[model samples]
Target: MKLYWSSRSPFVRKVMVFAHECGLAERIVCVRTVVAMTKPNVDLLPVNPTGKIPTLLLDDGSALYDSAVICEYLDSLHGGPRLFPESGPARWTALRRHALGNNLTDNLMLWRNETLRPQPQQSPEILAAFELKVRNAVAALEHEAAALAADPVSIGHVAIACALGYIDFRFAALDWRTGHDRIARWYETFARRPSMVLTAHVDQ
Candidate 1:
């Protein structure tokens, strides 16, 4: 398997973290690919029309994009407790947390793009809205951190951690730990996981 990867992408980190947990990290060959929303990378166009990173080129000659799908696929290949529960309430909870995490990350990334735009083209209103959204999301996580911290490690946990990591990497000025004490404390330990320690995001 081949993965079009970017060290700076949290989405890519999710997949890599999943791979590491599943003990399949050594099997995939990572091909570094630079990509930006406004500036597309031609090399990725042939394989993934969206020119996205973390695109998986499977050995069977097929491809899979999106961290959610790729992580589930990798989880399926493993034998231990599934990152994605196969059914019932556990499945729903995992999916819900995972979605919330992804959504939080999406808004943050968009907020970041807005900041990168020329000052004249940037929308202060949009940035403010997302900043509020992130604050509320972190507040909600503070309530759930105690439970999430005591886990067998679900894919949802992976998503949430990656989302938080992205904030620290790009929006450090936000200081997300302000009042979300439990979540902050939990993250202090979660961030030390070998998978996270190894795949820590890098700007360049």
Candidate 2:
């Protein structure tokens, strides 16, 4: 499999982290694909019209886009314990956590884009809203920190870790760890995992 990847994209890092956890990292060939909201990758449009990184190309000329979808596919290929729970309450909890984490990542990316604009073009209202939402999300994660630490690793954990990692990588000025000790502690350990250590973001 070939993955359209970017060292700077949190979503791509999420998929890469998931692949590593699934013990399928070696099977993937990471292609450095550059994409931006303002400038789409024309070459990537053939495979993924959205021109997103983390688009996986299968051996049979098929493709899968979206980190979550690609992660589900990777999970299917692994025979060990599943990151996505198969059924019942565990499944629901993991899915909910994944949604929370993934949405946080979305908000962070949007906030970043807004910040990247020229000062004259930037929207203070949008930036303030993103900041408030991020704070709320972090507070929610803090409440779930103990549960996250107790549960076996899941896609939810991966998503949350990636979101936090993105925050550290891009929004360090926010100093999110100041008051969120529990979640910060959880992430400190989670970030040490080989999957995360291997996929740490690079400005390039």
Query: Which residue pairs does candidate 1 place in steric collision?
Result: none
In model 2, the Cα lDDT at residue 83 comes to 99
**lDDT tens per residue, model 1, 1-204:** 999998999999999998988888999998889999999999889889878878999999989998898999999888888989888887887898899889999999999999999999988899899999999999999998988887668888889999999999999999999988999998888899998998999888
The estimated TM-scores of all candidates read 0.97, 0.99
Candidate maximizing TM-score: 2
lDDT of 1: 0.91
Per-residue lDDT of 124 in model 2: 92
Looking at model 2, the pairs that clash are none
Residue 141, model 2: lDDT of 96
Candidate 2 residues lying further than 4 Å off, grouped into runs, are none
